[model samples]
Target: MASSDDAPRVFQPLPGRTVDRSAAYHALLRELLSLVGAEAPADDEPRWQDRARLAVRKAVKARTVQGPVPEEWFEPMMRATVHEPDPSFVGHLVVPAVAAWGLRPVLLALLDHLDNGTPADVAGVARAWYHTGGAPEAEHEASRDLYRRYQHTALRRFVTLDDLDARRCLLPGLRLQHRSFPPDMHELVDQAVHLARTSDDDYLRHRVEIQTRLT
Candidate 1:
């Protein structure tokens, strides 16, 4: 005969305020108690393959909402199994530090633009890619080496395939040593050179020089 409203208040707040619960809350509370009771102490090296597989599945889902490029990669490279729960089970390890990299599209767009010499267009794509990729910290830089290779391949393909007419931009040498620069510093130097000469602005030239030194 006693429903939740008919039952006495179990919790007291301030002197003036009291709390009451319904049958659903009580049922949920009972379930929570049962869950706590069901928990057991876990081993330090307990089987986490399933957990890891689930985590990678979650990561793949996160990647899919980005766009086609990543989705293509995800469908093939994103599979997981209980025996190999870690994402790096297939190849390179996604370390804690690099795990927060959402820069794949930026790098891809940048390389794409460099090949096409449409810096403004490339910059816009880079921004969009980053937006879709989410905040840089939220993204994992899983395959850096693979990413660089993809960029290089894309650049080469663009150069070989794309039309280059009515464009006055000078083509930077494909080889890094032609500029006699370190591999990591090469792209910045090249972009700076392009922006400086193309803009014909003394300030931009100076800025490029400054960035080149920093890079």
Candidate 2:
């Protein structure tokens, strides 16, 4: 028998206001966790993996966050980060709220998803990390290494991945915001481009242009 309380817990948005997008996102999160072999943390569990959530919220303006942020909110945001956060999700989360608050969460979130097997999404994370001001020296000692990893490990891994969408999203970060690349970086780019060409899909040919300004 289904518990009467379970229905509301599954459908209700954190903070008690009903938001269609939030509700749908919560449902999708549970499904993804099942697929990934992870389980939802109980309310009594320690949901925060680190101080990143605190740093993100503390940076927010007083007007936006009224009081102590409900803990359930972190479940969705942290889960989103672990999945190597999508560009739209990053945009919605970072640009509107956290990015303006502080770039620390941006860097922390990028750190969490370095090995998720999608080159473009990783690059997008790196791009957002840098755009929001990568690794302030006072805060993080290994900031430069993040960019190095993006070039050497994350973006370069595209050649080994078969995700067409990752390939499509690759061009934007590659073309924009790149100040330096390792000597063999072009070789990897050529290989990825070659793979895209062989597929002969127009969407595979898509190139995301650099934004002139943050939206």
Candidate 3:
């Protein structure tokens, strides 16, 4: 058998060419094995190999009208079909909350720019702000309600924070007010308050500065 490192690189179908089923299957298996070998280290080889196999199986079962499998489907298949949540799952949850707080002013500024028909470089900031911010009281009540709902929902399946400090790895470019879990929840709560204040301040500042200059 050829080593994974020597596996065929091209999977894209050539124009006006029909793919042979046997050849395509071999090519895909080689690619999958190569990806698994490249991503998995020696220490946890078996576990990663199992995950790769499961990912492939799930992808195959879920395949629809497939010629060559779209490459993007593979990673999501790996993540979604995995039996255990990766360590980054918690990190992923925390980053958005931290960003809602840490980037409140910038988001408000972006919204202000958007309202005035000015272009903003930060795409999705406005949408993130709306989803995570709004009226302070409403946002706070919404957070509390979500916490209650999650308490009752499938989120209870996950373990509680055993290592707060270890889990609170600061996401890039944003400074969270608190670094410890549980306590850092206050940082997320404070975002609504900051958004309310900054939205007002930004409105006044823009009116005095940009709008006045335009007038």
lDDT of each: 0.30, 0.41, 0.28
Off by over 4 Å in 2: 1-24, 28-75, 81-89, 96-101, 117-145, 176-179, 206-215
Among the numbered candidates, top lDDT falls to: 2
The C-alpha TM-scores of every prediction are 0.27, 0.47, 0.18
C-alpha RMSD values across all candidates: 23.6, 14.5, 21.6
Candidate 1: which stretches are off by over 4 Å?
1-120, 129-138, 146-199
Ranking by TM-score: 2, 1, 3
Clashes of each: 2, 0, 0
What is the alpha-carbon lDDT of model 1 when measured against the actual structure? 0.30
Find the candidate with the highest TM-score and give its number.
2
lDDT digits (tens) for residues 1-215 of candidate 2: 11221100111101111112333444545543443334454435464212232333333333245555433344354444433233433333444234233444545556555456345444444433323332244434434455455555545655776654444544343422233455557676566556655675555443322211212
Q: List the residue pairs that clash in candidate 3.
A: none
Clashing pairs in 2: none
Which pairs clash in the backbone of model 1?
Answer: 99-140, 101-139
Writing each residue's lDDT as its tens digit, candidate 1 over 1-215 gives 11211111121111110112223323332332233232222324354333333344445444435533233332122111101112122112122102323345434434454445333232222222222222243232443443344335433432343222101111221222214333765564465356445554344344434434531
